[model samples]
Target: MSIPSKEFTGRHMLMTTVAFFTVVIGVNVTMALYASSSWSGLVVENTYVASQEFNRKAAEAKTMAASGVVGKLSFLHGAIHYDIRNRDGSPAAVDEVAANFKRPVGDHEDFHVAFAKVSEGRFEATHRLTSGDWIVEIVSRRDGKVVMHEADRIDTGGSGQ
Candidate 1:
């Protein structure tokens, strides 16, 4: 005996079209929800105020750069360290070293740490970071004026160092 094959009909086409659109719409909704729940991408709270101070901030940054002061930031044994140096590779004089740690996507997990002097141009903080990406802004001040400001992106691997 021979077996008869099933025939393709309008009902099958309608079901196929509905399934395809359902899958597409489901994926799009999921992606949109994730995107909206993640980062807000806000650099500053008030853009107009920031714009007003832009020229003065730019001038200050230029002066800081011209001062030939640079800083190296590192993490070791769960401690945060910063080394400040002058153009001649000598230790730069800084009274206080403060670090602001922020996540790239969110304000949660953001923190501030003050560093103590370990030696000339070397400062260390006893805060441990969780293993992830971080944006660290190191600011060195002398006589209540910022002498060096550096921003860097760091990835702490599974070690959290």
Candidate 2:
């Protein structure tokens, strides 16, 4: 005897569609929540104010570049080191040095380190960093004015520029 074949119905199509959409929507919602929780979604508090300050900040950077005032940063073991110099290759004297070490994708591992002057134009601080991508920002200020501001990307396990 030949076996009877079952026919596909609208109910089957409906269930298939529902299952596909459910999976799609479920994944999307999961991704959205994860992203929102990990990042604050704001690079600055006020975009308008930051835009207005852009010109001034650029000018300051140019002035520092012209004077050859620059900062060099390095990371090894658990310590961060910096060296600031002027056009004449002399150590640039700054009142303070501070740095922010940020993970590229999350805030949970971000930290700030205050540098102590080790010698003329050199400073060092110990940080707790792991092996990964890091965004490093170093600011040198003299008399409450920024003398040098530099940013770089460094790999914790390798030498960073």
Give the winner by TM-score. 1
True-structure RMSD for candidate 1: 6.4
lDDT of 1 by residue, 67-126 (tens): 899899888888888999999999999899999999877788899999999998999999
lDDT of 2 by residue, 16-69 (tens): 999999999999999999987786433666899999999998987788788888
Q: What is the lDDT of residue 34 in candidate 2?
A: 97
Local distance difference test, per candidate?
A: 0.88, 0.83
List the lowest-lDDT window of 10 residues for candidate 2: 152-161
Please name the candidate that would achieve the greatest lDDT relative to the true structure.
1
Reference-based TM-score, model 1? 0.71
After superposing candidate 2 on the true structure, give the runs of residues whose Cα lies further than 4 Å from its correct spot.
1-42, 158-161
TM per candidate comes to 0.71, 0.66
The parts of candidate 1 lying over 4 Å away from their true place are: 1-42
